[model samples]
Target: MGDGPVTRETTKSAADDIRVDQWAGGVRRITITRPTLRNAYRSQTAVEIAAAIEQFTADDADQVLVITGAGGAFCAGGDLTSSYESTHADAVQLGHGVVIREGMHRVMRALALCDKPVIAMISGPAVAGGLALALACDLRIGDDTARLGDTSGMVGLLPDEGGAWLFPRAMGTDHALRMLWGCELYDAQQALELGLLTQVVPAAELESAVLALATRITRTAPLTTRVVKRMVRNAMSQSLHASLIEAEYAVAAINDTADVREGIAAFLDKRTPRFVGR
Candidate 1:
């Protein structure tokens, strides 16, 4: 961020104890760093992940976020050794209490709530909560070597972390139930066939593909993109008339932005608009 000294001092910490690397051209890559543990998510890691995403939203220099894992695994799921040892099923009522499941919810909410698009680039295994994380992203591009599954049933736990909500919405109810109940792993091609992945690129081309998508997204007017995103989301819960009203308001707002002016001028001149993300 090229913010002045005051803004620099006030900026939130991008990542804490997580391997978060920010590129110069508005792309931030967040890697779960604990490869020895296969990137199992801990409570602190979840909080840090949320904080990192919040940082990305506040920083005008960054427009896209790509989340992946280190050491060839996206995530092995929740840190089972830690959670299982601590949580007692008998202590909690049937969904009446907090259930101490806030970590997963917070992580999922952070990604889903972000205004900008998120892309998950997967190359290796994603099981249980790990698969849920990838599913939470707006788009997923995987390599041939990737694997995805919900292994919670195998370990005697119901799928958590918005998996139950997101999976049914992504894949049909029957397919989601089958994967969760059967606890089977699907390879990249199978995942693609099942509509879990947007595209399957070679392992070597994964990074480039993700970057290209980010570049394409950032080339548009930033405010227009944000409004269009909201309109699409609103359509899910509201009536078409309400959605159209929102879209009209958004278009009016976008027309007032400097990027819209540049876009109009560029179109008349038969040239590409160099958007400044205004």
Candidate 2:
């Protein structure tokens, strides 16, 4: 990844509903472009988002992925018109559940399991499934205008796409319960205090802040970064003993990389190391 923006083959689905931009320093930005809908995604849009994330993970040049929305709002959640009402009349009772489980849930799972670091850049509301999507990322940066919460309760729905699991893990069981039960929406500062946001900046500074963080991450050795991401995510579910065992394997693997040698040499030589992601 160079310092300049790089061109890559853009997928048709991504071009239409999602937009993928590869910036220098191994950062790939995936933007949800349905601004008129406040970035609300239908089932098909969720599939396109999953596809873009899959591409980012497989692209060797990409080390960090930043997910955001165009026209201010991050995401308003699933497109109810396309997902529920239109299909509800024609679909069996279970069909609605099936559609969500196979569609948006898969997108959330992809974000959660991505080996590379994923960051959510939230400039506006991240409601319901949209909040779940943001929670799936490894880190979240929000702007002052940002508002986040689970809005499903208002509509007599549950946070079906990993919100129940992710919210509790991120903000503890009690806080998660309150938010879900009350449909409590928090402003950017409140979200930061609740540990929902990694950092919050003025609206105008959000992009620069996200870019600075991404740049810092890309300067590290790629192999180590990926390994660390995997290890930490695994630790969330794995027992301490199992996590240690996995870390042992990861350490051995990373120790063998040329980047490790360069890191050691750089320390001894008292100079900044240039990593080629070897």
Candidate 3:
């Protein structure tokens, strides 16, 4: 969570490369603004995105996060052919993987630590590190024009930004390896079949669909949502017995919250429950 100053601004800010905005239904949206190169992010762009994610993680009022790109495209990944050396010259010395460690790695770390749910709103191409970024999120909603793939080998760079670990898990090891080796790109429907996307809508309806999804999530119990995100992600690697034990612990902590009482009372009364994040 971010320890820096965080405020709930009523308006959206787009002065920087990454636009951060807090919307109704307690949703925070982060948009990469470099749409010319299909939103191919540089080091500064990664830093800004990481900061936005951390801020969302820290803010109490924000219930869900929506990450997307401006224009028609999603992120095209990091610019491998750019002047990365000049950008990193001021920060750290050149060494084994120092560039990514200081740049996009911060984003991966932030995403991993975030207890809140993240939704990747993918529109156009989301390849390479961009694909990894989307995979890190709890859910991915894409449009029909959406594209996903790995082009790391073509540029002689590995998916150093969490793709190496996330790709194999999203779509089995064999399929992930096949796509990686072939530098394959898939359309939204194909990505959905491969388990990369949760849902795919038409380009025109993408915004409304994503907004509806976020609003639906915001109506859920906030504390339960965060805990469920963590527990489910951890359960992927945990045994059934261990997961049960973890669930017991979670229940123990959550049963005492005022929201639980509100939920039970609302159920008996046949009314909507008002949760205050207690």
Candidate 4:
């Protein structure tokens, strides 16, 4: 959808190598394009992902975001082949080496902190760090072929990059521990059963399913949607009373937005409101 002439501001840059294309209507798609490595996040790719997500958050043109992979594989894990070798076993050697960089941590944090509602469209294997990235989104829609799990333990490392925190809340603590410690892989139905995926569809329907969800979400008042999302996030770390107060303030803030006035006017006129995401 970003098919127009590339201006200095709109031209793709090195820091935004992770492709982010904005659809003019109100949706943005961020695709992890390194399919040759099963879309694994390494130093540069992770940084690019964070930068792209930051760009999406700053853009008022879109109200919904869909994150997906570019090819058959969604993501495998960290780029272990590049990160380690038998000779680099010792901490001293590993610390001095640039191979095992920690750029993915910044990427994970950016995904979690972005205010836009993110939908993960998983079409293939999304294991280890990939699953962690999917879980950070507001919703996950996976194809029947998709696999979700943390494979960190299999590679002799504990789960990092928000996996340890998100899984405990998403699935129960016991389920999270079982998946982590046992290194069990979960298919689409298993993931849905465990509350990991919001919906599971055939591979051909995966992208359409996520877009449908995005469409419905965009039909709501954007300001209120963000406010409710923020309040729910605050409730995770704050007291119930505090969360209620936060929600109250958020509602007050959304009341000042143009979308709210348009919504009211449309309802009075018995017509659909065209929210500008203002």
Candidate 5:
């Protein structure tokens, strides 16, 4: 799939609270629009996010997916007040657990299963389930003003929405355990040092930095890019020998693409190659 403009028929419905924007260079930006509650994920919001992610993966024109929050904050977490039940006092503990499993878990899984590259654009606080959402992305670009943490322990709760699994994988088990247990928050610089963020920029330059990186990624052949994402994700669980075999097969498939020939020819000619993602 090649990068191009999105058509009306391919566009998703606007009824979802999340804002979906497909840019010219294959970047699909999904913005959480709720800022008053710090963009917390209600059951409906989680469903919308899951749907947007699925649409992004299915759209050939969308090569990269960027998940961001509107206003100053990224997300506060799951909106405890926005449950389907009439009131929190009337809701059973089992019902609350089911909501987390069915709503937030689905959103996190969608991001994890996406074949294309996914980036989390964090400009402010990403706490609790919000932290889990950011961790699900393949890469994270955060502003210096951003804060990251898992505050579930503070409220006598567990990180049920992929946090227990994702946090340990991103930041080591020791660091993840400390954060979860102490309910500590890390500044953007600390997050970068701890490997939670791929890069940190000034708040004013966050969008530019993210766009630049996405543009660079979109310059590569689409098939190669998608294959690399899948292979690396699989490598986390696969044995080294198995990963090597997978890489060999991936290389063979990529070699058969027209973009490979163009890439080589352009290199020999000392010119910028134009890849159509063939």
Candidate 6:
């Protein structure tokens, strides 16, 4: 989006939760805004976020997605009041699982399925479902002002919003259960130590640092970035032998991309490479 369209879809309340901004170098940032609720999402908010992610999935013009929130908080979790609202005419006839499966669960799936990179910019509390949202991202950049953990159990709830699986995978079952059961909230430093955050910075530098990283990613070969992301995710559940075989084929295909040729040419010419996502 360095020299492309710039758009801002801003609206108050859950009617429109998505505020999409185009930064330089094909970086598309989506800011979730629900200031009255500490950015806590309802059914409509999750739907909008999921829709934005699905749009990003196909839009080649966008190379990266930065997900953050307006105000101080990243997200507080799902809005409990609306979590079980069946009075709405559009409400599903099915039970509780369907509500979540269609709401935040869809948002989780969208983030997981997105080919482009998703980075979380955590400013304040990111607990319960909010933690799941952050963990779903490819990377999370936080500041000392932030708090991270699972507090769903305190309210007699569970990590139904992707945390059930994402938490364990990120910090192992023991740590995940400890946090979930204990309803613990950790500071930014503790979150970093627990592998919940990629990096932490001063509150003043949080935005700049995350944007800088996103920009750096945009400068890399797009094909390489996508392929590497896929390969690594696949390797997590695959055997070493299977992973190696996949890498063999992946390298062969990557070497043939036009971006690879451009990279080689740039190296030979002693110049910065310009990748076109070919």
lDDT minimum window of 10 residues, candidate 5: 1-10
In candidate 5, which residue pairs get closer than 3 Å at backbone N, Cα or C atoms, i.e. clash? none
lDDT of 4 at 171: 90
Q: lDDT tens string, model 4, 27-141?
A: 7877888887888876667777777777788877778888888787777777776644334569536562444344667767777778879888898888887888888889999
Error of 2 at 30 (Å): 0.6
lDDT of 2 by residue, 166-232 (tens): 9999899999999999999999999999989999988888887888889899989998898898898
Best by TM-score: 2
What overall lDDT goes with each candidate model?
A: 0.78, 0.86, 0.86, 0.77, 0.85, 0.86
Worst 10 residues of 4 by lDDT: 1-10
Candidate 2 vs candidate 4, lDDT winner: 2
lDDT of 5 by residue, 1-278 (tens): 12334422234455666877765457888888888888988888898899889888887886888889989888878776766433564575648777766688889888878989999999898998999999899999999899999887876778988899999898899999999999999999999988888999899888878877887888888888999999999999999999999999998999989999999999999999888988
For all predicted structures, in order, the TM-scores are: 0.88, 0.93, 0.91, 0.88, 0.91, 0.92
Q: Alpha-carbon error at 181 in model 1, in Å?
A: 0.8
lDDT of 1 by residue, 1-278 (tens): 12221211222355543667764366777878778888888777777777888777777777778888878788878787765424566643444135335567777877777888788888788888888889888889998889998888876777767888888887889999999989989999999998888899888888777777876787887777777777777687898899888878887878888998999999999999988877
Candidate 5 C-alpha error for residue 57, in Å: 0.3
lDDT of 2: 0.86
Alpha carbon lDDT at 86, candidate 1:
43
Worst 10 residues of 2 by lDDT: 1-10
Estimate the TM-score for candidate 2: 0.93
